[model samples]
Target: MEEQTIFHIINNMDKVTNNLIVQWNKVFEEDLGVSHILVLGHLKVHGKSRPSDIAKILGLTPPTLTYLSEKLVQKNLAKRLVDDSDRRIIHLGITDKGIEVVQRANQKGVELRKRLFEQLTKEERKQLLTIYEKLNKSL
Candidate 1:
């Protein structure tokens, strides 16, 4: 609860996240950016989804999602679907290639995390998981 403690926690969290991203990028071997991979992952999990919904869920602006989706569509990793009942409604769906990309990215991510967490003892890992879950639930 002290100011210094909060600052240290936040600083360490940022460093951990940056390190993970940097390491992931090195092993990912994909030309896509994190935002693009996140969009693909979302579509893989959620099936077809409205751009607005994806934007809200991902904490991105509608225009930013639009730009990201445009790149995805161009790469054939995703497609636009027009609602049958309402032509005004549009959804984004991931393709087979997108699924493959997501799977590869996930594997690399898991491997990277495992290597990073291997530094901790089993009990420390459990404590970290519990603490992270508690912090996430607060959000």
Candidate 2:
């Protein structure tokens, strides 16, 4: 609880996150970014969903979701479907290719985490996880 200690913790977290992003980008290799992967992952988990729902779940703006969806559709990773009963209702669904891509991305993510945390001992890793869980609960 000192102010300086809190600032140091915040700064370290930011640095760690930025480094993880860099590593993620290296492993991902595709043209898609993290948001695209998230959308695809959401669709894979939730099946077809409306753009508004996806936006809400992902904490993205409606316009941002629309843009990401457009890119995914263009890349054939996802498709937009109109509800049979309602012309105004549109749903976004992941394609077969999208599933494959998301699987590969997840595998790469696992590899990245393993590489990054390999230096930490099992006890240290457990402690870190516990600390993170505590911090998350507080948040």
TM-score of each: 0.91, 0.93
What are the clashing pairs of model 1? none
Worst window of 10 by summed lDDT in candidate 1: 27-36
Q: 21-119, model 1: which lDDT tens digit per residue?
A: 999999898777789999999999999999999999999999999999999999899999999999999999999999998899999999999999999
* CA RMSD, predictions in order: 1.6, 1.4
Q: Which stretches of candidate 2 lie over 4 Å from their true place?
A: 136-139
Task: In angstroms, give how far residue 26 of model 2 lies from its true place.
Answer: 1.4
For model 1, how big is the CA root-mean-square deviation?
1.6
lDDT for model 1: 0.95
Error of 1 at 2 (Å): 2.1
Highest lDDT among the candidates is held by which one? 1
Best candidate, TM-score-wise? 2
TM-score of 1: 0.91
lDDT to native, each model: 0.95, 0.94
Tens digit of per-residue lDDT, candidate 2, span 61-131:
99999999999999899999999999999999999999999999888888888888888999999999999
